[model samples]
Target: MTTGSQRTRTVLHLPCLGPDAVPLERAVAAVLGYARGRRWLRFRSPGRPEGRWVRVPAFGWARFDAHPPSTGPDADVLIAEGLHGRLDRTGWHAVHDALVGLAPVVEAVGARAAGRPFWELPADEFSVLDEPGTVGALLRHLGQEAGPHPAHVLAALHHRHPDLVPHLTPTTRRALLPHVEEGDSGVEAVVHRELRANAGAFAELEAAVAAVVGDARPGRLRLHDVLLWLTTTLRLAHAVELGEHVAG
Candidate 1:
């Protein structure tokens, strides 16, 4: 589809990076640990025709996306293109800061796009996925326009957040985009149980992320994202072991 910017865009779910033996989740945590203190972190104005300077995080994820295929107008794509060199030089920690700085703008885009089908929003708005808490707002903002698969909210969160990237990677949004969306009691129960069981771990991860990002802890939706990601990863892992794809 063409983005509102009128640029043709395609969305693709790339395979998780790195060796199969090292789960994506664990690799990201390690990247964060390595990046702490040693890397430069700052929020800079997004670059335009010629960019400004910013320190990049040491993580490969940042550097990698900083140079995505030159075909999309999504926010993350634009941001990545804007910060291409800076990200390559600097890395994930800096990219994380950039995403955080971009959060409000992304949310604003969602607010404007509210009540419209997601695809109808400007392509740049899809970049909201790269930020921490905007997708839920986007989904809620979508209201009736969220269509038949609001569980795609989980996919959005997983796509954006580094911590959830590998573990919850979906080759296609359709894989996780629920047909009958939820508000169902069964869904609520599962959410509650996952939250309870993983509360301590989530707390630790949040604290770690907060410390690294130099911000208040991420919002509730982002936290819930962790739980949803974990649940999805477990299912996906099982499917992999069974030599079958996850059921859409």
Candidate 2:
């Protein structure tokens, strides 16, 4: 790995498509397995605003998702896996803020995609770990002695299962590409321009709605606004909010 600023790390998605595409459950299972049974790795997915907070024995993780390169231990090396139609930067940022582990920056990386690749909307900056396979490298980075994490095992199993592989399409491919390259190409530039234009339209609509509510709905409108921002962040490719439909 070419050394950059060790203090300031950037997060990138793992590019391995994986056999049949492994489900995140399997992948997380692999992470647990690697703990060498030393600590208890619990994935706490509460059905409330608090969401899930995964704890591995001595490793205590807070339940907030923050932006990439988290400055505090609250969010150390984060691994953002799998994104759907929207990136949900807002939710991911929340996740990053909540993350607290051994690493410094809390971010996530994965190739969990549906219909097409989820590339365009990534953390601040990204690159596809295409060469030696992202999972293997991650193991090495975490220390080869520990072995595979339960998450890794689960992911591999999920890959073998045909039900997990998400289909691909031009849109997904386009969405994911911006995240892997070192720099934005001409195509990416055009897409950014169009997305900016759309942002203005969305902003106008939001203003109109706020005006209509006019304190009548109060928290309802505010809550909708929050959701809208989260939705916007998702669209921007910060984090994948899979919990809206899937409870755990």
Candidate 3:
């Protein structure tokens, strides 16, 4: 991990992909199992936006249909690690902003996709994230909402960039809002605080994941695996706090 002005950046040393590695499904199940005896987390869904919230106890299951970073274990591992690398240095709020900013476009693309998978879109389409106009567009979308919850956009970004695991979503707010309601710091502030304090443990976990998954450096997948792991860890931790039972 490399520390910068605001936060630490992670350089993932993923394990090599090979037949000897634990099967992808098994690895996914292990992560999801951590959610056992935990509460279900809710988030706004890109597919159903009519004031509907999706439940995610674990990303492995689909209440309706699957989302991105598909079952291709190689792709999943790659994307997860790529996201991990990004989150290592990015302040939680910056990540929140980027996701929120990108929500409108993700929704727009999904609408046009009409239930198509995100990977179906040509690579050229994803270039929109780098475009300057997107920022202006997001502002316009948020302006029309009542008592706008700006952080919700961060949740919506998951539709396409599943690699960018959500942090400021409605689900996370369940855990963080009490603090804010009590005139305390927001969720990201607290999580980042805890994460920084226990950086060594997280580092060890990262290495463990690499060993379990494959120790090769992340490639096109980037830090998706890391983000997935982080998101799961947050969910499980909050669930325990709520004393929610794991799904049967």
In the range 1-248, model 3's lDDT, one tens digit per residue, is 32232122323222221113232223323433432223355555666555454444443222111324434323332233333322333343444554445545556544544563332333322233433333223223333331233332333333234422222434444543443322222333333333344344344444433443342322112222323344435543442332223222
Ranked by lDDT from best down, the candidates are 3, 1, 2
Better of 2 and 3 by TM-score: 3
Off by over 4 Å in 2: 1-69, 72-79, 82-171, 175-184, 205-248
Q: After superposition, how far is residue 149 of candidate 3 from its true place, in Å?
A: 10
Give lDDT: candidate 3, residue 151: 37
TM-score of 2: 0.20
Ranking by TM-score: 3, 1, 2
Q: In the order shown, what is each candidate's alpha-carbon RMSD?
A: 17.8, 19.6, 16.6
lDDT per residue for candidate 1 within 43-120, as digits (tens), equals 555455354456654432343322333322233433433322333333434444444444554456445646553323
**Ten contiguous residues with the weakest lDDT in model 1:** 10-19
lDDT (CA) per prediction: 0.34, 0.27, 0.34
Off by over 4 Å in 3: 1-58, 61-166, 180-185, 215-248
C-alpha RMSD of candidate 3: 16.6
Q: lDDT tens string, model 2, 21-101? A: 223332222222221112334454545545545544221111111112234322221322321212256644433333323
